[model samples]
Target: MPGYLLVFFCGVLFAAGLGLSGMTLPQKVIGFLDFAGEWDPSLALVMVGSAGVYFVFYRRIIRRAHPLFDVSFHVPTRTDIDQRLIVGAALFGIGWGLVGFCPGPALTALVSGYDKALIFFVAMVTGMYAYRTVDAIAGLRTDEGTAVDG
Candidate 1:
């Protein structure tokens, strides 16, 4: 229950930060992406500020015995880039460029009852489900092939 409360509080804080930073507006994000035209550097500034904060605290947090809530920190182990990673990154970039709303801001904007945010969220969820379905099917096929060989 405490863990859930902490997570909820963090989520609220994140949403508030996004709203305060003008990140909930698709137009702002689109403006930032428009380098040839009226390019906005505010988002870049926000990114830099966030990175600075993380840089200041990330090492200290990691050096601790464990997180306050979790038993261990689940950091990513993989450092190698692959074709799948490249393709996924490209798709993510294209989606962000087209809609001007990534998952975080899109979810945050949904509270304002924006139709575009709702549509984007639905499409994003559908894409996630589609990926899971395809991955599961591929895994089953691989398992069946291994069983047949053994």
Candidate 2:
């Protein structure tokens, strides 16, 4: 399908951008986090550049009738910050600070046969599955038996 192909191509492009930006390297990310030590501000440029581009395009895309691939814009309706969000964000930050490998960079680095990347990827996947299992078991429903967002 064209949508699937577009998604694949976009993923490749994203991976390529991460590689070219030196984001696939744990050392680069760690260096950026090392404020009291040898800090690398170069990654900030990459972040800012990405945010700027997304800011421009996100506005333009939302204004359109619909996306090229989807019938509707899949936007989050939830606005209130809750315990689940805080805990998840804290965990993500801690993992990123420790391994210096978020999902995207880790996946991109996996192709280069990086052992750490592989390890992180496995752990990340396990964590995701664990969360899903727990969430499924502990899922909350309303009086009408409709699933509610946490």
Candidate 3:
């Protein structure tokens, strides 16, 4: 319960930060990506700030005996970047470049009554479900016979 509370609080804080940083706006993100144009650099600053905080805390947390609630840190062992990973990243990049609404920002912007962000969020969720359906149909699996091991 405490871990869940902590997660909820952290999520709220992150959403608040995004709202305060104008990251909830698609125009700001698109402006940042348009380097040939005026190019808003605020998003870069936000990324750097987030990375810095994560760097400091991630190391500190890993050094502890274990996660406060979990028995062990949920770390992935897969180091190889497979085709699925590459294609997924490319798709994400293209979506972001086109709509300027990544998952986080799109979800946050839902409160702002932004039609485009709402559309993007709907599309994103649809895409996830579509991928899951296709994977299930294709019978894609790891050597362990798990539906999701990657």
Candidate 4:
């Protein structure tokens, strides 16, 4: 109801911001990534602006007892960096550098009927499914080993 509507509105706002900031353009993202070559500093400014806004509001928002739509704020508990996190981050960076389309902007570009964006989205979905499948298999193996040990 209200929560869902708020979520929808927020999503639309985020998409509009991405579009207006030229984040939906692959060339812009690629240019930003190309530091050794013709580097674009606009995306850096966008990131700084976004970080500033978050810094200004995140503390105040988290101090609230509950979110506007939820019982409590959902926050990450893990603070330690591990090998898996490092590997995942490296993969994400490589993918973004190579394709010039992260998930959010890629999704936004899909509305424009861009074939590359569609391909990227499909590949992203496939990667997600693949990760889930591997994780499930690993979980099953761990469960079986624990049961045998017990």
Candidate 5:
């Protein structure tokens, strides 16, 4: 299969999984986060299932010489916690908690015809472009360090 075709299939499968698991619903995510309210543990189970699947297959897939669609696996090698990671994580958590919509699920939720999904996605992309522009103007190599290249 062609690489783009494989990607399209994978996305469709992912969206289907999200739909089947109720992850595309913001209420489901909000329910999970509502510790003080009628707490829903179903999302936790879904997360666990997804994580377990990744745990089982991650090593197996990484052991391959190369993926069928990609020339090289672009795995991150950085392990140490840094300011960027910390800030990024905090922002992600804040966004998720405030809006109850994660990026992947948000994209899937777009088909639901909710205006908030579109708004959130637009803001997310705007933030990304804004960050890149700021980073470029700061003379910093993306994800590298504070020093400017001579």
Candidate 6:
């Protein structure tokens, strides 16, 4: 398969998994998060299932220096808790909690045709672009602390 085809298939499978697992619905995520009141544990199964898959394949992926397509696997090397990282994380958490829409399911939720999902996704992209612009201007590289053994 072509590289773009592989990527598309992966995305399709991911979105399908999210849809089948009810992850595309914010109520499901919100229900899981609201542990104090009317909690739903179904999302826990999804997490476990996803984690299992990650655990199985992560080792294989890490064992190889490069991917199947010969592209180097880009890894974040930053260890310090810098201001940009802190602020980005805080913003991500706020967005997630506010709309129960993280990036993964936000894309999956596009199938639902909800205006709120569209709005959230737009805001998310805007935030990402804004961050990238600011980071580029400030020379804030995420891999600041890593010493590459080249």
Local error of candidate 3 at 30, Å? 0.3
Off by over 4 Å in 1: 133-150
TM-scores for candidates 1 onward, in order:
0.85, 0.86, 0.85, 0.87, 0.84, 0.78
The models' CA-based lDDT, in order, is 0.80, 0.82, 0.81, 0.81, 0.81, 0.81
Model 4 residue 82 distance off true place after TM-score fit, in angstroms:
0.9
Return the TM-score for candidate 1, rounded to 2 decimals.
0.85
Cα shift from native, residue 31, model 2 (Å): 0.3
Off by over 4 Å in 4: 133-150
Cα lDDT over the full model 3: 0.81
Instruction: Report the C-alpha lDDT of model 4 over 1-150, residue by residue, as the tens digit.
Output: 999999999999999889888899989999999999898888988798888998999899999999988898767655555554566678889999998998899888889898888999999989877865765654522222221110
TM-score, prediction 4: 0.87
* Worst 10-residue lDDT window, candidate 1: 141-150
State how far residue 146 of model 4 sits from its true place (Å). Answer: 19
**lDDT per residue as tens, model 2, 19-94:** 9998988999999998998989989999999999999898888999999989987776666666656666788899
Candidate 3 lDDT, 1-150, residue by residue in tens: 999999999999999999898788889999999999998999999999988998989888888888988898765556665666666678889989997888888888888787777787898899987986665565643334323332
lDDT of 2: 0.82
lDDT over C-alpha atoms for residue 49 of model 2 = 95
Q: Which residue pairs clash in candidate 3?
A: none
Sort order, TM-score high to low: 4, 2, 3, 1, 5, 6
Error of 5 at 95 (Å): 1.2
In model 4, where is the ten-residue run with the lowest total lDDT? 141-150
lDDT of 5 by residue, 1-150 (tens): 699998999888888888898888888899999899899888888889988998999899999999888888767666666565566678789989998898889887777788888999899888877876765665543465443211
Q: Tell me how many residue pairs clash in candidate 3.
A: 0
Q: Candidate 1 lDDT (Cα, whole model)?
A: 0.80
RMSD to the true structure for each prediction, in A, is 6.2, 3.6, 2.9, 5.9, 4.5, 4.1
